[model samples]
Target: MSAGHTAVTTPQPRPVPVEEPVIRCETPQDECGVRDLLDRLGDKWSVYVLVELAAGVLRFKELQRRIPGPVSQRMLTLTVRRLERDGLVSRTVYPTVPPQVEYELTEMGHSMTHLVKALSDWSIAHRPAISDARRAYDEAHPA
Candidate 1:
């Protein structure tokens, strides 16, 4: 053992505390409602819309452009509508010749986005491990 050397350690980042109370499912009705909302929010299109809106407000066309795979117009419309219904997004329409419209995240939406962003960060950080697991599974089981 060296007498002069000291141990070194990496510093850790502080964690952000969750401020909002999670929705509780105490009854059958409550459980159904909560599950429905979660299902809608977890869908692929909804996640994409949320990611785009997290940046700032955007018109419908802008949302369409930002999301990859060029989500269909009907699908985009449906996704935003569902999010709006759930109070996570606000829609503003301007009375003009073309009827300008824009969508932005509500206060609650921002809170939800924080959680989504954390999940996204975690996914990116562990992508290598996820791929390795998938490859190992595929190799072990051939079609």
Candidate 2:
């Protein structure tokens, strides 16, 4: 190359633009809504009841049977009532020789099933890792 001459190099191609997911910040109202929801559905029994009801309509006894652990009838009743109040479940009464009552998910409740199922799936998938972490923490902390 001549001392006064400079070689020209080709410019590199620009990177293709990729779309990023939109992120939303929760407002104060959103926080209140979340807190209210957590207050209503915070208990294990409520979550279990919702999960069972996600399948289909069920009678009180049937719901109890479907749940894995021991949940008292009174607790189940309360959970259902709370869910009903939250507009997450609907209760139907049929008049017969004896009155029959059934509980099923409302449209809003159905909408939440995917989220609940995803939570359950995540819990199941991470259970081993969580257990390992707990064990490690316990050992490290000696408590």
Candidate 3:
């Protein structure tokens, strides 16, 4: 080693400790309530309807148009009714020769917009991976 040369040693990084997530235990009633809410939110049409309304108030036909894919009028009607019953949506009727009805998200429903959007974004982002997984599973199962 030359007297003028000095060896340099870099410090190693410390490992970060990850804290485990806390799992909360629910009572029977709480479980039932959660199950019921999940069932409603998990419905095929409910999330679509909520997403559509999240933009702004939309008429029945407008909502039907905004939502991607095919959705029956009857099914949309039922879905809106269920959302209304859950206090997640509000329906307003305009006074006119022919009444025009509009659907919008309530305060409670608006509160869920962030969660629904996050789920939607996640689903869209993972769609390719999910499709690949499905294809692989189907190929293996041969069904």
Candidate 4:
């Protein structure tokens, strides 16, 4: 209560109103094309195969080698089949003395290069955070 001091009231900031997210749960079957594509893209193996194919057309063996870890023959078969059916990948067979098969991205799949690349970039950037989380989980429950 100094004689020359004046009490000042600070203005309170208004809370930012969070607008509810518009969730369109109802979409006509016709508009489901992109949604279907997104489902395919979201698949773990599908995205891996797509990224590998982006380098160039690869033979089945090459794809198996390039992808890290061991993937079952059945899983690879199913993933490729799904991608092919979705028109995102193309499989070609060359009739040689010993038949050769190669998988390549179709025009539609090629269109997703930027999106996939962005995802790859994000993964690299966030790897430390992901690793830290894993370490924390392991520490919380020791074997």
Q: Which candidate is the best by lDDT?
A: 3
Model 2's lDDT to the true fold? 0.85
- After TM-score superposition, the amount by which residue 118's alpha carbon in candidate 3 deviates from its true location, in angstroms, is 1.6
Worst 10 residues of 2 by lDDT: 2-11
lDDT of each residue in 21-138, candidate 2, tens digit only:
4544466555635677677667878788888998899998999999999988898888899899989999999897678899999999888888788888999999999999999999
For 41-106, candidate 4 gives per-residue lDDT tens digits of 777688889989988999988998888878887888899999999898999999996889899999
Q: On TM-score, who's better, 2 or 4?
A: 2
Query: Would you list the C-alpha lDDT of every candidate in the order shown?
Result: 0.86, 0.85, 0.88, 0.85
lDDT of 3 by residue, 37-142 (tens): 6877888899999888998999999999998889999999999999999899999999986889999999999998887878879999999999999999999999
Error of 3 at 97 (Å): 1.9
Model 4 poorest ten-residue lDDT run:
2-11
Candidate 4 runs further than 4 Å off:
1-35, 125-143
Better of 1 and 4 by lDDT: 1
**TM-score to true structure, per model:** 0.73, 0.73, 0.70, 0.64
Better of 1 and 3 by lDDT: 3
Better of 1 and 4 by TM-score: 1
lDDT of 1 by residue, 1-143 (tens): 45444333434666887786665566676674667657766687998888899999999999999999869999999999999998989999999989998999999888888878888899999999999999999999987
Q: Rank the candidate models, highest TM-score first.
A: 2, 1, 3, 4
List the pairs of residues colliding in candidate 3.
none
